[model samples]
Target: SQQGEEDPQALSIQEGENATMNCSYKTSINNLQWYRQNSGRGLVHLILIRSNEREKHSGRLRVTLDTSKKSSSLLITASRAADTASYFCAVLYMEYGNKLVFGAGTILRVKS
Candidate 1:
């Protein structure tokens, strides 16, 4: 399966600090999207940057893509305890949006 694999399976950070996570994938992709899970209801879309793009940011979240290396990085600054959740990066192939696949995910624990 040419999918993404998130690192630090779990992380602990203090509120008002920052959290960084890494994801590596196999095979080329059309785009990559990051999702956040809270209360296990489902995943909420965070960001989606294409292969031709380099970096993208939304509020406190920042994402970088390296197509050649088949990897990506996510940075969240000024993290809050409410931000505690699992983060997963999904590789978007030609049928990405149609049939999205998910990574193992990294659990973020922000302590207040």
Candidate 2:
């Protein structure tokens, strides 16, 4: 079984907007991390919030975790064309062999 799943496999928006993505998972985890990937670029670590933490913010990015619901959310404020690319969330845990199983991903396109 897959550890995580993300919706809206793709997203597009005008520059200077906000983009939101949701993730759902099927197991317990120590924490969840969000990562961004630009076209032909490697995955860049964004932010990670522990299971005990409800939310975390980094720059224009906001992340939320709901352990009980086994879900999480990421909200990017004032998005830009630079944000265009694919976004993904990974669940981390030793229970899963300490591997980062990523969701399919959400592709965001910001129109300039």
- Cα-based TM-score, every candidate: 0.92, 0.94
Worst 10 residues of 2 by lDDT: 92-101
On residues 15-42, what C-alpha lDDT tens digit does candidate 2 reach at each position?
8888899999888888899999998989
lDDT of 1 by residue, 2-100 (tens): 667899899999999999998888776888899999865699999999999999999999999998888999999999999999999988777545556
Every model: Cα RMSD to truth:
1.7, 1.1
Of the candidates shown, which would achieve the greatest lDDT relative to the real structure?
Answer: 2
Clashing pairs for predicted structure model 1, backbone only: none
lDDT of each: 0.89, 0.90
Instruction: Evaluate model 2: give its TM-score.
Output: 0.94
